[model samples]
Target: MGIKALISKPFAAFTISKMNKWKYNAVAAQEKVLQNLINTAANTQFGKDHQFSKIKSHQDFIQHVPINDYEDIKPYVEKVVKGEADILWPGKPLYFAKTSGTTSGVKYIPISKESMPEHIKAARNALLCYIYETGKTDFLDGKLIFLQGSPVMDKKAGISFGRLSGIVANHVPKYLQKNRLPSYDVNCIDDWETKVDAIVEETLNEDMRLISGIPPWCQMYFDRLLAKTGKQKIKDIFPNFKLFVYGGVNYEPYRAKLEESLGFKIDSIETYPASEGFIAFQDSQKEKSLLLLADAGIFYEFIPTDEFFNEKPSRLNLGEIELGKNYAIVMSTNAGLWAYSLGDTIKFVSKNPYKLLVTGRIKHYISAFGEHVIGEEVEHALLTVAKQENVEITEFTVAPQVNPQKGEMPYHEWFIEFVNPPKNLKEFAVKVDEALQQKNIYYKDLISGKVLQPLIIRSLKAASFINLMRTEGKLGGQNKVPRLANDRILADKLEQYIIEK
Candidate 1:
């Protein structure tokens, strides 16, 4: 279905006679969109040739796709590598968004011109929904500091990646475009280092009213900004920075450090940003995450977290899903990714389809040793331990690594940067272990010597962690220190610094 039809379809499916009455209409509309996708995909050559053509019903679609991971899509990506078009979409692609695939190699996902409006509208709906929930529409009128992806692609007619933010930046409304804090659009520039440097120079003097971007990149920007001005507080640089909008990864680990670095507790909002599109945002003033734009061209599927890694993950479309359980998000966008599993996991906070929270990345989950520990579980467990001990953290990452000692099970090791380091580090470690044990039965079993050993909490000077990432060519700019490293490569590297010392 076209964008205009997609918008109106929901209303037509159910009676959205008034604004308050629109909720039922949304649910109805979502089903219609899915039906349309099933029909359209059956008719299209790409869809027909692909497995999606066999999807006689939504249930069949879920049963057929097999919940693809990045490895499964590698062959398609190889096609993309050869400059092939019409693989995912019907028409010639506008460009690709070059985002690093967390589990494997860097991915260059195609974006089509037709899909661009869906992206734009998704962003608009995300913003409008936030405003609708909090009555904060006036905030959009302020000077905005967008910490967007730097444009590395030279503008041309050919399909390319690394131009997502550039495309979005150039495509926003002209009136709002005129009001941007810095005239420079980082996403449009070819050289990242030069673009970032220019952005740093431009914002040095301007009153940065609102800052928005991935938290890691924003953190780097703020860190450099603070260092340059010789100021300890965030207010010192951008006195007018009323709102701090961050998305992408979980910001819990960095929250204490960010608050410490900034010098004030600014209101923060977490958004779910993807290479495909902006999926959701925390719309409530109380800071709760919401789901995808229900009325947009995006259609969603939720696979139960328990079955997420299974070969045939049993899926739940909008009507079948329930609240409070984690689900692997499968999505179909106007971008032509039918039943595309984007490796994101979320928990429903409310019964409303739009009310949801980003719990963790699907790849970040650790169940290797039967301990299905997720990012939220770890974050909460750490918080519980900290609260009990009255200690505060700057930043942290948790990894499950094999214990070097003979006959020991895999254990979770934490690299923590502390604001208030406990005098007795061993006691602090015990407290954290106790908290995790209480949180998860599996963790408790592991701690009691039935399975794994007690988790080891290693404290590192905050600067050391920062320097480590910097030395790896991953420090500063948009790169974030990975929170939950699944394998030995990152875990072993961290172990050398955190364990040996």
Candidate 2:
């Protein structure tokens, strides 16, 4: 074993042992984190404005601070961007993580000195926990490729500004610097396609063992790899490849295709990292749930998704959350965010250690006709049916078809780019519709009541979603296509990309 492989054994043990102190005492750790954050930032202007010094309990914290979306806290973020000291955190942030969304244009999220370590440590400890669980550390000796954004940062009011991944690139530990692949210059390329091509060149012959990125971007890199080397399987190019780490989007839709392209089933770790915080990670190889980072400088509140739009939603702290119920996560962090709504939804599967599965985006749902359909339900329905039919989906999205052609009833329109499309498309669509009805009662009622017809599947051209993402200027690095939309904006746009058989 290489020195890293040998050293990782004790390191992993020490790290996971330290982690257990908080994991077993998760709720208490959360309470302490909230108090620490509040106490630490009490001298800041935001703290004073919100009566942080006076707050003694979670309820008091909620009463004092309203749950804020990015829009609600835009003023504070603006001030922070202007180099205002103690505007949000105790002092000016070390960096601004610049993120752009479809609806919310550009957002500058603060990365305070205190919060930065939390992000870094949580990521590092994820690997440690994995090593402890599986006793696999030899991959650390081989080149580790992080399919990420440009490491080049920009200046905003003298504060370093860049994508979260880029900011993280600056923090890659010196030890792993030698093992990291895709030269810095290649990573700096602006165009994603150009970057992937360059990456293929740089890491083609390297002893790459671990690959990490969002699923779509990783697929892009794999495609580029095969094109450049003419390798049938990724494992053929780098037989050492054993681990695939992914975040940002659900991997179920792309899993079969990725494994097929790679020519083998590989180990994967799902991470829940947002610009706001490093929330959770898969600690066990056996379970799909990601272990929540309770002591990672972020205090979490689970507001039931059903009550999210109410005047004052019930913001339940860690102890109050129940398993199997969907909740919109609200976080108060050392970054100085007070009761910030993350806009992502999650369901708890385990309680003591607080392991969870990210269901979908809170607002990214299909509720056009009162039959609220979520990403989890849709994915479960489609993937379940597709598996039984031996169909492989490359990419897909759903939109409510509020209006249909003359003499036809409106229905849910599924636009799918299939890797292995079913032989009988109509029968497959019926199976998917039935699966969806089994998952959601509202959707079943609408279908049975004749208010809506069974879903219609539109087989899209190969790389349709890719072309759409590229055209929208969001081709890579944590950008994801929403699985379903309530409005026709995305769905309507997808109409032109459709290919009729």
Q: Judging by lDDT against the true structure, name the best candidate.
A: 2
What is the C-alpha lDDT profile of model 2 across 1-501, one tens digit per residue? 999999998999999889999999999999899899889988898999998899888889988999988888889898888878998898789888998855668998899898898888988888888899999998998999999988899998899999999899889899999999788888888798888888888999999999999998899889889988888988899899989998999999999999988999999999989989999999999999999999889999999998999998899999999999999999888888889999999999998788999999998898888898999999999999999989999988999889887878989999999997899899999999999999999999999999999999999888988888889888887788899888888878788877783
lDDT of 2 at 17: 86
Please, what is the TM-score per model?
0.86, 0.99
Give the TM-score comparing model 2 with the true structure, all chains together: 0.99
Q: For model 1, how does the per-residue alpha-carbon lDDT over 237-268 read when each residue is reduced to its tens digit?
A: 77767778777667766676677887888777
Candidate 2: C-alpha RMSD to true structure equals 1.0
Candidate 2 Cα outliers beyond 4 Å, as residue runs: none
